[model samples]
Target: MIVNLGDQLFMQLQLRGTIWTQTITNLRTNWAVNFSIDLLGQSQNYLYFRIEQYGSTFVDDAVYLNSKWKFARPSNQGCTLAFRGIKDFVSTPQLSADGLSCSVVKIIQRAKENPRPGF
Candidate 1:
């Protein structure tokens, strides 16, 4: 389902219990973004993302994380988005693996007129 992110922006996510995947493509551009999170087995809580442009792999700048939308560098091999915070993940909602959360990927300072996305 299309999880509306306010007005123009939205995300499509699929979750099967502890494992999930998401794909977000830019309709106006050739950018295709894909991400997956595995919260089970050895790859537990591992978050990864890949980007493609014009059907070709493209490695650009850092991805957004943190509350202020800070930049987090990707791997040098390609646009491999990896989170390096599993070592410090406590059983709490205050900490984020990639300085990001499922509820609020991009924090908004202003009020949203649109309703929040739900299951």
Candidate 2:
């Protein structure tokens, strides 16, 4: 989900017999753009994502961050993402012994907009 500063997005996923929820928050006081994947209730052993700037106007100063789980079960978790000024535009998944895979089923983006009633 894409979120600007002061905004929060919540997502829930169900896997096996458990339901897990993830909440992402943009803590910057200024406008910040980011994308996140929540593998809350998933059993996947690995996850990865690649970011490409579609236009030349896209500046290299933009920063992106990501977090994920590294173990077969949720008990062993890991989080890593590129910081500002970093050159790596892709993230590699840290997999578990089971070597499972994950597919993105749904995505939701929330951006703050002027409040309007009954549009």
Candidate 3:
């Protein structure tokens, strides 16, 4: 799929060793700097991302607890997975100015007491 800077997309992140994956929808254009991924998420000192675009597949980038960034080549199937150690931060999903990395912040989820129908 061809994705530009302003295109909104959905992201499904599956952390290693975890049986369940989190499905994030309406991720917005700020997070599509790379290709559409199926499983991508960060817990606390580790970052994981997969790149699936056109005929190319690769992990693309990995950030460790020390705030280090590394670029790896695509694997045989065009898909790659990486793991690293980094510092832990409050997890509030945030996009960086360059749209390359996600910042750390606390996330709070609340349900609407009253439901509103579409007009």
Candidate 4:
């Protein structure tokens, strides 16, 4: 027997609710998935993302840290994660150089392993 349009719409809503419930539950159980990423595209429009997970976090943010000017105090006024590595390519746009660990993966990894930078 053919069902009424209202019944079909209700069934669709039920299916959607089930999917939404599962998604919310998964997100709550997994802290790794409950975060955001900000991609900072460099000059020349070169896309050089690690194309992989950075630590336990899902998406990675592009932060530029300097070997000399390390120690970024994000708690300071006007300081934030966005400015962790701000001075790198802001003054002059240039292609990311692997020699200086300009990739997103390296920057994030460095943050996790701050003390033992040589490691």
Candidate 5:
């Protein structure tokens, strides 16, 4: 789906298998921007970057953008999928294992509490 951020800026979101990605276009002329979030990761780890062009090469400053939109909240139990704006997640782990761990427990519990109708 495509979302309008304002003016001429728009974002494109996509989900495939285990990975979800969002690409922001018409924001800056010198950089290409996007982010990828893994719904099924221990760290609930995500990546956001604005690839800045330097002559002929692109560089990863590792900056990110956030949105009000969220996913898998039932599993988050109470964690979050909200605003985690710009940061070098490599040097700074984005989320806590404890926070993400709750999601796992919630998933298992939900499965037990609400079993599927059939195979």
Candidate 6:
């Protein structure tokens, strides 16, 4: 499948009063198949992501807390996930007006440049 120039995707999980968010942007679908991910929640300092591609499943895990975060993978299937973190005081907030929680934020998935062929 060809993802075109600027496509987006995401996986979200609501767990125990907390929501885990992940997003992919600027996606290129060349050499890819069956791409999806699920947030298995966090443990200690590690955020676990379960990724499924081409019938194979694995984890893209990272150790991060109270900081900006991003994750990307390129293979027969490719993915890019990002978090804007906290905006500076002088800068306008993207997700919320009051501010954002380091633990929980919003996740969005959309086709920025082009949508899939068949509506």
Q: In candidate 6, what are the lDDT values of residues 44-94, reduced to their tens digit?
A: 233433223455332322112122232222122111223322321111212
- In model 3, pairs of residues that clash are 13-40, 45-86, 57-78, 65-85, 65-86, 65-87, 90-105, 92-105
Across 26-52, the per-residue lDDT of candidate 5 in tens digits comes to 653424478998876443433232333
Tens digit per residue, CA lDDT, model 3, 42-83: 233334432224564322221112122221332231111232
Query: How many pairs of residues in model 2 come into backbone collision?
Result: 0
Candidate 6 RMSD to the correct structure: 15.4
Q: Of the candidates numbered 1 and 3, which has the greater lDDT value?
A: 1
Give per-model CA RMSD.
14.3, 13.0, 18.3, 19.6, 16.0, 15.4
- The reply for model 4, stretches above 4 Å from the true place, is 1-47, 54-56, 66-92, 95-119
Q: Each prediction's TM-score against the native?
A: 0.27, 0.28, 0.22, 0.14, 0.27, 0.20
Best by TM-score: 2
Deviation in angstroms for 10 in model 5? 1.9
Q: What's each prediction's clash count?
A: 0, 0, 8, 1, 0, 0
Q: Model 2, which residues run further than 4 Å from truth?
A: 1-17, 29-42, 50-57, 61-68, 73-119
Error of 2 at 26 (Å): 0.9
lDDT for model 5 comes to: 0.36
Q: Model 4: per-residue lDDT, tens digit, 2-82?
A: 222222111101122223111111222332222222333321212121213335432323333331111112212121223
Prediction 1 TM-score vs. true: 0.27
Q: List the residue pairs that clash in candidate 2.
A: none
Runs with alpha carbons beyond 4 Å of true place in candidate 6: 16-44, 48-100, 103-119
Q: Compared with the true structure, what per-residue lDDT tens digits does model 1 show for residues 25-103? A: 5544535577888867333333333222345322322232231112233222221222323222212113234544432
Worst 10 residues of 1 by lDDT: 110-119
Model 4 accuracy (lDDT, Cα): 0.24
Better candidate by TM-score, 4 or 5: 5
